[model samples]
Target: MAIILAITNSKGGVGKTTTCANLGAALSAAGKAVLLVDNDPQGDLTKVMRSDPKSLKYTLANLMNAVLDDTEPELFVNRAVIEGAGIHYIPANSKLAGVSSRLVALQMSSRYRGGETGGTPCELVMARVLELFQSQYDYILIDCGHSMDLLTINALAAAHQAIVPVQAHYLAMEDMADTLEVIQTIRQGINPKLAVGGILLTMYQGRTNLCRGIQDEIQADYGNAFTVFSSPIDFSIRVAEHPIGAASIFAYEPNNPAAKAYSAVAQEVLSYGQK
Candidate 1:
């Protein structure tokens, strides 16, 4: 049931690591089976998957301290895996930005605040890194790290969904009103199985006019909550020379036009995984 997501945007060059490395390599070139999790420590999706995540040595901070000792966390997973058409990677390091204050002080002294933290402390360590891979990938995503703390609150409490690439300037729709009021206060408290998984539009130029007036002011305000991607991603130059030239405009041109606008935003995210 892997459908995680969480591409986030508290604001930062607004391509969110090139839309999480070309929508996890365009949903693994549309065959699915992707993974991508680079919870951004400025690793830039493991340096655009060209390696040198400080020369890796098992990352995701040893899968968050072996899921805080309950262990069995994919045995500190490390594939260093590099497939081409059906993406898979967990390679994010800058030492994962010192794993958010040791996972917010070890889930703040734990009693199960959420799991390792306990009592649902905003989805404790992203639900211990999504219960060790959420039954192995079909799509996990998560490329955050623009800011909000605790690694964007454990990737929006381990996401059930979230996109927001944004960029067409003019304060990118006023910084998406504080990231949609912090995703509407994390959907009123903490993840109500989350949603808003759309709103891409990165780097667009559309022959200017303030980039089509900020895409008609982000579809005249949130466009009925969200769902904007109708192929926009522009301002190429091979996606601005891929994170210091590693690669990803779905490997430099999976049929251009910003890789077919992330393959029509990954087929509008597989039509929301068929509802």
Candidate 2:
């Protein structure tokens, strides 16, 4: 079985997609078969993986549609996946915005009609879909939308673990509390096996007092509660530029500080998952 992980933060601009792209690449480089799932409507992770949303013939939207329509899982799974940059992925686009509604409607209809007991729930849609590929990949990383919507809920419900990429800033820390609360809620009701893989501090600047203070505060508050990764991803122009170039940091600038940090984080993830 694959270790399914959701790279998510309720706050936007917290480097969630960037972490997913780079970390997936780093894991792939380490010889792990990785599948990156773009769960955001923006398709940033898809683009970073070098797949254009406009050019994509199939996406998460199509897969979800197939799942709800009772189509064969293999057909949509094969059609939606695209391989690139040493990884495979199911891309997402703006059409994914409608998935939440469709899922909700399915749930309501199931309740009203007293549907079959084995039917998948709204929150487990992604989980059910990904199970078809579990034997094919070692790690499945989901880049989630920046919200506690149905999409993010599906990602959390599907994941065995979650990696939260928090920017070293006060507002990001504040937003993290909400994210953690939602994770706790999901664990309590939806996925009891889900665990927080780690809290990754991103865009960290060692010289900045504000960054240091924020990091210190996070460690003080969450250190005992979760594993805050030792190597904070440093603020790097190289990291920011890679997405625009449709490449991962490892591929664009392997020696960059941010790249090394992500590599270390991937190793940590692998080690921790083993436990």
Candidate 3:
């Protein structure tokens, strides 16, 4: 079975999509079978992996909807899984917003409340889709949106662990608390095996006093509770350009310091299976 990791944060622009793509690329380069799942409605990860999201007939939303309708997802799952930059991935688009709303509606419905629907729980809809792919890959990385909505919750419920990417800033440190709390809630109420893989400090300017201070604060606050990855992703234009360039950092700029940092992160992740 794959070690499923959700690259998530409750705050946007914290490098969730970037981590999901680059980490998968790094692992794939290391001879691991990687599957990236774009869970965000913005489809940023999909855009980075797929030349055109609209050109695809199926998506993550289709798989979720298949589970919602209690249909065989294998039909759509195969078509949705596409390869890019040496990683297989399921793309997402704005249509996922409708799926989120359906989850909300189901949560509000008495039929769902009474189990009359007799289908997977709203929070586990994505989990049902991912279960089919779990055994086929070494790692499954989910790129989540910046919210604790049903969609993000579904990702958490499905994942074995979460990799939180926080920017090296005081405010980002503050946001980390809410993200951890959500993970804890899921661990307590939904997936008991769910663990936090680590907190990754991204957009780091190690030379700056401010970045160093935030990094220290994160390590001090979260280190004892969860891992604070030793490797901090250095702030670089190359990272921000990967999605636009439609390639992972390894493909875009293998020698870039940011790529090396992600490779370090991947090493730390691989060490998890060792332990």
Candidate 1 has an lDDT of 0.75
Candidate 2 per-residue lDDT, tens place, 99-148, comes to 87887787777788786435577788898889988999999999998888
171: Cα error in model 3, Å: 0.8
Give the Cα lDDT of each candidate. 0.75, 0.88, 0.89
In candidate 1, the residue pairs with backbone N, CA or C atoms under 3 Å apart (3 or more residues apart, or in different chains) clash, namely: 107-117, 112-118, 112-119, 113-117, 113-118, 113-119, 113-120, 114-118, 114-119, 114-120
What's each prediction's TM-score?
Answer: 0.36, 0.94, 0.96
After superposing candidate 3, which stretches have Cα over 4 Å from the reference?
A: 110-116, 243-246
Evaluated at residue 14, the lDDT of candidate 1 is: 86
In terms of TM-score, the best-performing candidate is: 3
| Candidate 3 lDDT, 155-211, residue by residue in tens | 999999899999988888778899999999999999998999999999999999999
